[model samples]
Target: MSSVRIILNFLSGFGVLANIFLLVFYTFIILCHRPKPTDMISCQLTFIHIVLLITGPDIWLWDIFESLNIDNDFKCKTTFYINRMMRSLSICITCLLGVFQAVTISPSSSLLNKFKYKLKKYMISAFLFIWSFNLPFTCHRIIYSGAFTNVSETKQMKATKFCSLFSMNHIIRALILTVATSRDVFLVGLMLATSAYMVIILFRHKRQHKHLHSLSHLKASPEKRATQTILLLVVFFVVMYWVDFIISFTAILLRMYDPVILSIQKFVMNVYPTITPLIQISSDNRIINMLKHMQSLCHHIFKWR
Candidate 1:
């Protein structure tokens, strides 16, 4: 192992612990508040964060323990395929969240408002659609990856190896990459469009309700904050998605299977999942109120002393 990889592993190990803590925090918030109908997407986002943290960067951290008692190909393929599915699913959920919020704030007379009123009713069905859609696409990953024990190293190292089955067939490998890219592009495009539309609506509302914004700035603040929070999340997700996409394209098309490229891609992918929970807590009114109360309680106790 290189010094760089060792350092990366240590950092991600610590992040894994932090991610677990934040996962519990968000889960508790959802449980306590019983998320509102509009907030259901936020709850789903929280759960997706939990899924990604457990399966993303932690995969590398846990790879060291793989036992080659037998050819553990089954475990490797299963774990790798599941991780891919989780990563893809998280993106889909994010796009869903953007659309959900966009429709939510649309004017009552607009077509989007029609979706707004009905979206909460079909939240579970929408999630079911995401599952039914992305899960099947990731089945291709199982065909592409498997467990392999490398004998080149003195100690046997078993890891989930990708493109093992089709490494020799460049054309099929390219086709697989093309299909995955096209799917993501279409979905991400929707995310971009929705985010843009949401921004436009917010901008128009601010212009139309300037008096309301000034007279009851407190009321306007929460709505603006919520919209900004969702928009910021979509923007961050877009940056991460594009970075991963470009790296993925190079890694697949050019077969630039360098450790550095793989590590970079994995790091970018892991960063969002690990950090998203904190963002959720920041946006959550209930969680913020709880924190404020706890702060005052601690201060009062210390002051009494």
Candidate 2:
């Protein structure tokens, strides 16, 4: 189990480093030009990547417990708080990305289209709202475990009793678990539904294009490709989320404390944000073109343009 935890930590660390490079690359692209909706999503995902990159190192350090002495209780509390907040924020942002894509692909005549303009205007506000809504939970996390104490010297130290990530009381713990589970389920359902609707609409559009057989509609291909890209993202979300949820659920149910399971959970949770920038780069032509243009500019700049 220890060896397994070490391997998982290595993989998670690798993921964090990869995400950092991708985030910086995407940031360069965004700085060079105005970003589209997909680019905005990538920007938000980059923020998530940075958060994970910082916290992932702490988790890796936590896994190698025997090597170093973590002196401050505040460090533990801060790390715990940041990790939980970033995880929740990532989940919320991914859900927003799905809904945003759904809205982007929606037909002008569709009911969802009525709010399309509103969505565009208030997209940043929506992001802020979710972040604010999650603030209380993040703030509550700080009250949990603080500095580590040597339990061997102080045999009477009730570490688990005094310091908990969440309430240790059975009822409160159950309530917290229920709420978290339901929230995740709701977001997943919304993403799946929106993705499914987009798929159906795209299918119908393709059928129409097939029947028309008109060479004038070159734009149809791009639209179809965009829809496919979103579908792929939705699939990625569902699979990653389910895997993480299952592991977490099992640990919660069995009261298991295996470090290996914890490492796997962290890896799975961080995987989506780490891969998200790449997905945006692959799926959006605007970002790709912007990146190419930036490369051209960089070369000219170095040549003293």
> Which prediction has the highest TM-score against the true structure?
1
Clashes of 1: 0
- Candidate of highest lDDT: 1
Error of 1 at 127 (Å): 1.4
Model 1 alpha-carbon drift over 4 Å, by segment: 1-3, 6-34, 57-72, 149-165, 168-175, 211-215, 301-305
Model 2 CA deviation exceeding 4 Å by range: 1-14, 21-32, 57-72, 146-167, 212-223, 290-305
TM-score per candidate, chains pooled: 0.81, 0.77
Model 1: which ten-residue window has the lowest total lDDT? 154-163
Please estimate how well model 1 matches the true structure, expressed as its whole-model Cα lDDT: 0.70
Clash pairs detected, candidate 2: 73-146, 73-147
